[model samples]
Target: MADYQETLDLSSYAALGDSFTEGLNDPGPDGQFAGWADRLAGMLAARRPDSDFRYANLAVRGRLLDQIVAEQVPQVRRIAPDLVTLCAGGNDILRPGSDPDDIAARFEAAVVELREHVDTLLICTGFDTRGVPVFGMLRGKIATYNAHLRAIADRNGCRVADLWSLRAVHDRRAWSEDRLHLSPEGHQRVALLAARALGLAVDDPEAPWPYQPTPSPADLRRENIQWAREFLLPWVGRRLRGESSGDHIEAKRPDLLPL
Candidate 1:
């Protein structure tokens, strides 16, 4: 492996990929999305307060795996940070007629390149979407892609942030109103998972959710209708028109500045 400035004692971290890493739906006090990357950065920084730890998140919403490789991978290579996290392919898998094998192949290629530069390259698996609405239909594909991601991790000696095994996120509370992105608690849990993957002692990512009464059948019908109108339809329209929510969106944090 090439010389990384810090190995165990990480002084900098970077994140790459799409909306999840960009911290979608997990709003901060200022209303900015302070997704898992930011939360993990906090954990990493807290681990070593003596040194100046820098962090950057070069993730944009609605980006495909190829887009992530093209746009963010080079920046990661250039910066050569100590620790790097990559979570991609969700958007690609969401597309109609998407091939999990192909996405995994490209994802593997990205992982191969990324592992060479950083001291520790952490890659994430796709979530088990069985608990999510609409997306649940693609669970097979996502699971297939996740299997590939795990294989790639083993082959490349990269760490895995195994989102598929996280039972907490399987609950409805972990998802946002749109049922697409994670909620604040969900992002925090993901951050904890990442920290644990990095060998940090952290909270249980699988902590049980608070109690809630199951909705009636009529309530489910009403909620489904509301969801279709408010979120699903707009998403479908964007897909049909070849328009992305991230058409003009830029990475929230492009530079590897001090944390």
Candidate 2:
């Protein structure tokens, strides 16, 4: 529970980072990547229905922490939105031989730069990938990163949307078919977390997953093989060729506009 009793006077918002912030996999009203940020923006607009509320999302898929700091942090200074939500560094840590501490330093620098400009800053922690297939191995690294992030938030007076402890997203159904990005429901769950972190009340509980029998060992092994062939192999191929899914993609909402 957020245990938040009051909300700030939120008017404008800006979201920065990688695919998670960009709203990939979760289709929006216009049928674009409308992930947690878009959903949270909707809630913010709903709070001030007749008033002017604007939001911008500058996140792109496959963006590294450095890319986010270099590209998106400057926009916060220029736009000077009332609220800013940044969720970066996942891509960097997923890369071979990347260090969580190094990524945290860059993230903190961006946070410091942003704190001066925005009224509220919400920083998301790395998700706990335990129980997932390939991502399970990354649990320890993500935990270390989350610790760093929590400390950063405390030091900088930023709010944290702690994804690691969110039980709703740990369910298998919360993930997309590829099991890399979140499914639409997962995105919705995160948006609720974001709103709660902002001291906004969220009364509804997340929907429970449908009942399913536990998978046998063979079933799991078979699924892993299929996933590796269809998703992992292609991702590895992209890495080898130094390409990104967002190489040609641009921000869905590049400028702050009325919701």
Clash number for each model:
0, 1
lDDT of each: 0.88, 0.88
Residues 52-132 of candidate 1: C-alpha lDDT, one tens digit per residue = 889999999999999999999999878879989999999999999999999999999998888778779999998988756
Each model's TM-score, in the order given?
Answer: 0.94, 0.95
User: Which pairs clash inside model 2?
Assistant: 23-35
What TM-score quantifies how close candidate 1 is to the native fold? Answer: 0.94
What does candidate 2's lDDT look like per residue over 1-259, in tens digits?
4466765888899999999999878987787879989999998888895869999999999999898888888988787799999999999999989999999998999999998888799999988887777778988889999999999999999999999888888787788878888999899999998898888887543557688888999988998899899999999999999999989888888789998
Give the worst 10-residue stretch by lDDT in candidate 1.
Answer: 1-10
Off by over 4 Å in 2: 1-3, 204-207
